[model samples]
Target: MATPTAVVVGVGAERGLGAALCRHFAREGYHVLVAGRTAEKIEAVARGLKDLGLSAKAVLTDATVEADVVRLFDEAMSPGFGRDPSDLVVFNAGNNRQLDFRELSAEQFEDFWRVGCFAGFLVGREAARRLVPLGRGTLIFTGASASLRGKPGYAQFAAAKAGLRMISQSMAREYGPLGLHVAHVVVDGGIDGERLLKNRPEAKAARGEDGLLGIEAIAESYWHLHKQRRSAWTQELDLRPFKESF
Candidate 1:
């Protein structure tokens, strides 16, 4: 049998959830494609996995672009190196920022939508087009709490994420019967990752131990989702810190 392959898009810092997912899949003997908009970040992640004697390579992908999304699937479906086409794919591309609704410009809203919703749609569509034929595959989407709730000063992010959630739901309904496993993960609470730590150094201390979501812990849930049996497939899963309120 050819080696199994996994593709993770929106990978950033090595300490982030995306990188953690790559590492976990690599450890499971899957050839991982570390894809992201930043060449340096993705390359670093791929290099670190290689250093650990795992199979992974960096694929520079701007998930928001149509052509880039198409190209990413092209590479995933034709992965050589004695590996099978990607049977696992994750669309983790998105950004969040608090912007007052009254002051939010059209450009800012569109930017958020393009990244969080449009990109996910593009990836989902391509995955359906390719993986549906094989009759088996896993496509996971990384979502935020904003996907379900609209908080003040976060109109743009909430709108975009809510749309993404809808995309995942529709895909799951349309593809589950076709043997494509589509799931959405709603990540609640702040993640204990490089972005949060670097931006707000005090956040870790404020949240306390286990207060913030651990990247590895989050990645493990994704692995479980991929390993789930069809009879008990989960269309949506939520992860959050124990201390988190709802």
Candidate 2:
């Protein structure tokens, strides 16, 4: 029997949720394929995981590009790698730029959709192609509050995330009976990370103790989603800080 393999897209920084997911999956004994556009960052993350005696490799990729998405799966299933059809695939690539409704350009809106929705479709389709035959796999999409509601100045981000949410739901219905688990997770609070602290110091102060969402906790939830029995699969889940309203 081959070891399970996991693919994680959009591993932006060490402190972000994507990276956290990679670490958790790696610790669980899955050979993790870290996919992202930034070569340096992804490689650094892979190296760190390797240092911990975990199986990990960096696959520099732009998830928004069809060619790149295709290449990503090819590399994962390549003979040399000997990775079984990805046991877990996560579509975590997202573009969250706040633009006033009036200022949001068609191109900008499409860009978000390209990363947040189209890329997910590409990855999910490929993953299903492989998993359907084997009769098992898990696909997870990282969503946000925007996935549920559109806020002012976030027209583009909201639209894209909403599209992703629908895609996850549709896939869950279509593939659940085929032995594949598809889930969408909504992160509803500011994640406690260096980037968040640097950008919004006041948010940290306002959140109080355990007010910010911890990336590790989020990763743990994702692991739980993957381990769920077929009889009780979770199609969607929402995570937020204790202080978050609603």
Q: Score each candidate by Cα lDDT.
A: 0.94, 0.89
Residue range with the least summed lDDT across 10 consecutive positions in model 1: 93-102
Q: How many clashes does the backbone of model 1 have? A: 0
RMSD per model, one decimal? 0.8, 1.4
In TM-score terms, candidate 2 sits at 0.96
By lDDT, who's the top model here?
A: 1
lDDT of 2 by residue, 124-186 (tens): 888887777778989999999999999889888888899999989988898899999999999
| Clashing residue pairs, backbone N/CA/C < 3 A, model 1 | none
For candidate 1, give the lDDT: 0.94
Residues 135-190 of candidate 1 have per-residue lDDT tens digits of 99999999999999999999899888999999999999999999999999999999
Worst 10 residues of 2 by lDDT: 76-85
Every model's TM-score: 0.98, 0.96
lDDT of 2: 0.89
